[model samples]
Target: MPLLSADQLTIQRGDRALLRDFDLRLAAGELLHLRGANGIGKTSLLETLAGLRRPAAGQCRLADEAAGLHWLGHRNGLNLQLSAIDNLRFWCGINGASPAGIDAALAGVELPARARRRACRSLSAGQKRRSALARLLLQPRPVWLLDEPLDGLDAGGLALFAALTQAHLAQGGAVLMTSHQTLPAPLAARELIL
Candidate 1:
């Protein structure tokens, strides 16, 4: 079964209707890559699917009973004043996820111990991006909604994201993402143009 589906979806911003009558699905072990020009509602589509925004015309559905989902927006959703560890801990407390994976997730993103201890505002762009990506690992959601997920990554960060996403797919999870960069060589993705 498909992990997520959208039918007759319409997205708008203020007076502009950016997309209309769009339909898409993301199945388990698959990735749907959203593509469009700037200001073309890619992020809006993702937000609607992630339940952060309301679609103008249609609805989004999840086949899973648990509503398992992770949303990574274009912004690195981290607390600038908080340390990486602290931000992750906050996410854990809110999501009822165990803190055990915090360290491992940080390591998986190649965030050094020193970087983890510093406030997010002090970290480099790549580090901040990795910190946000770590949230995916901190919680085991079955579906991921990612917007501009590759914005600030270095080669290593990109590699880590590809590996982690592939692992998620292998485990029967699904992804819906927007990226301007090409995905890593081994990860296959279906393109959805706006």
Candidate 2:
């Protein structure tokens, strides 16, 4: 069965229909990229899929329970006063996951040992984004909903992100993300233009 399915989904903002009769299905180990110009509701669609907002019409069905999905939005979603490891630990608690992988997950994001102990507000934009991404490694989920995940990432960070995404796919995880750039080689991503 598909991991996620959206049938005849409609999204609107203030009576301005951003999407209508939109349909999508994502199976395990699949990657789907949402593309369009600015203000085209890419974020809206992702938010709807994440259950952050209600769609104007239609419905989204998830094969697994809602908690089995992960949503990474444009914001880093970190507390400025919290250390990188602490931030991930907090998220792990919320997800009912173990905190044992906190160190390894931070390392996966290329955050230095010293940096991991520093507050999130002290990190650079890319570093902050990486910290947020560490949550993915800390808590393995079947489906990922990412909005502009590549933003603020450096070339090295981008490579790391791609590698992580590929690893997730290899583990039978599905991803639905919005990105203007094409993914790196061998990811086998399908594209949909809004």
Task: For candidate 1, write residues 115-162 as lDDT tens digits.
Answer: 998999999888999999999988788999998888888888888889
> Residue 77 CA error for candidate 2 (Å)?
1.0
* Cα lDDT over the full model 1: 0.90
lDDT of 2 by residue, 95-166 (tens): 888999999888999987889999999998899999999988887789999988888888889889999999
| Clashes per model (N, Cα, C within 3 A) | 0, 0
TM-score of 1: 0.96
TM-score of model 2 relative to the true fold?
Answer: 0.94
Q: How far does residue 153 in candidate 2 sit from its true spot (Å)?
A: 1.5
